[model samples]
Target: MDVIYVIDILGTFAFAISGALVASKKEFDLFGVIILAFVTAVGGGMLRDILINSHPINWIGDLNYIYTILTAVVCTFLFKSKIAPLRKTFFLFDTIGISVFTLLGLQKGLSLNLPAIVAIIMGMVSAVFGGVIRDVLSREVPLIFKKEIYASACLTGGLIYLLMKQIGVNENVNFIISAIVIITIRTVSVIYKLQLPKIKDDIFTRNQ
Candidate 1:
């Protein structure tokens, strides 16, 4: 199997587990957990593919995606107590998921002959939109909307990947370096409680 394909599958599983974790926190039943898992695993990818006009979609053409999601959901449900306490582990998987998806989306966009700016946006969308959907479903504010450096990490990584590519870096090496950059940024931001400054609500209501 291609390395990118493998990374994509692993990323899917990671996202699925992340979604299941959130569902468990919300005390969702089995069906709801599975639904959330599936959506979180493929929601962003599906949207990205749709935007790019990829035929048959991604997960729809690959049954492995479904199986991967089911496995993640089952494991999460069975080990909810043990897994819930492992916040770091969950964060690690989530970071990996976003990192891999970002690269995949960027590559896909480039392959479609999209401009670098559009590709970068696609990468960011692929990395975070699933979590956005998941949060909306869970009735919580989306992480991207929060002060945390979530989508920005993906955007940073995507830019680095493009730069490395332009400089003739090996594809695999570029992917590894870019993914590490994203993961490190996210980890450090969480540890340091780093966040983007929020706009004051008064600014929006000033004219009103």
Candidate 2:
């Protein structure tokens, strides 16, 4: 089995777990939990594939993705009480998902001979849009739209990955390095309470 494929499955499971936990917290029904899990696991990848005109989208082409998501949902359902107390667990899984998804999308773009800039954008989309959809459904402000350094971390990691590839870095080495870069940035930002600068809250009120 390809290492990248393994990593992608792990990422999908992580994202599904996060979504399931959130839905559980929201007191969503079983159906809602499954729906959120499915969307959060594959929404970004599906969107990326559609935008690039890739055939049969990722989850559709691979039944393992569905099984992975269902397993994640079941685990979350059984372990919600234990999992919910670990405040950082959700963040950790989300970070992992973004790290893996970004590289996968970027690799796909390159495989299709897309421009590097376009590929980087694709990476960001794959890393971000799933969480965007998850948050929208849960009625929370999306992380990328808030002060968090969410999408920016993915974008930066994608750029560095492209640069490393150009410099003839080993494929596996480049992927590991890029994934770690994203995870480190996101984890550090959260640990240190770092945030992107925002306009003063009064700006909108003043205009009104």
Candidate 3:
């Protein structure tokens, strides 16, 4: 199998686990957890593929994606107690998922001859919209809408990958560098509590 394919499967697993954990936290039953896991694993890719008019979507064309998500849900349930106390587990998996999904989505867009900007948007959508769906379902504010840099990291990585590809960077090197840049930026921002500057609360208050 292609290394990218392997990474994509792993990313799907990670996203599913993150979803399952969140569902558990929300006191969801088994069916709800499974549904959430499936959604979080492939919802973004499905949306992206639909937008691009890609036939069969992604998970539809690949049984491995479905299997991986089901396995992740099982593992999450089996080990929830052991892993639940690790507050950082969800963040770790989420960061990894976005990093892989972003590049894969960007690659797909480019393969379809999309514009760089559109490809970047596709990458961002693939990386975060699943989580957006998860958060919306769980009645929590999505991380991308928060002050922290979430989707921004994916967009930055997508842009960097496109720039390097245009300049003829080695494919493996470009992928590695872009993924690292995304993971590093996300980790550092969260660790240091860095955030994009927000409009002051008074602005909204004045509007009201």
Q: Please list the Cα RMSD from the true structure of every candidate, rounded to 1 decimal place.
A: 3.2, 3.3, 3.0
Clashing pairs in 2: none
lDDT of 2: 0.89
TM-score for candidate 1: 0.89
Give the per-residue lDDT of model 3 (tens digit) for 24-107: 989999999998998888999999999999989998998899999999998988887876786586677678768889999999
TM-score of each: 0.89, 0.89, 0.90
Model 1 off-target regions past 4 Å? 1-4, 201-208
The alpha-carbon lDDT assigned to residue 20 of candidate 3 equals 94
Question: Using alpha carbons, what is the TM-score of model 3?
Answer: 0.90
* Span of 10 residues, lowest total lDDT, candidate 1: 1-10
Q: How many backbone clashes does candidate 1 have?
A: 0
Q: Which stretches of candidate 2 lie over 4 Å from their true place?
A: 86-90, 201-208
The residue-by-residue lDDT of candidate 1 on 107-163, one tens digit each, is 989999999999999999888888888999999988679778988899999999999
- Tell me which residue pairs clash in candidate 3: none
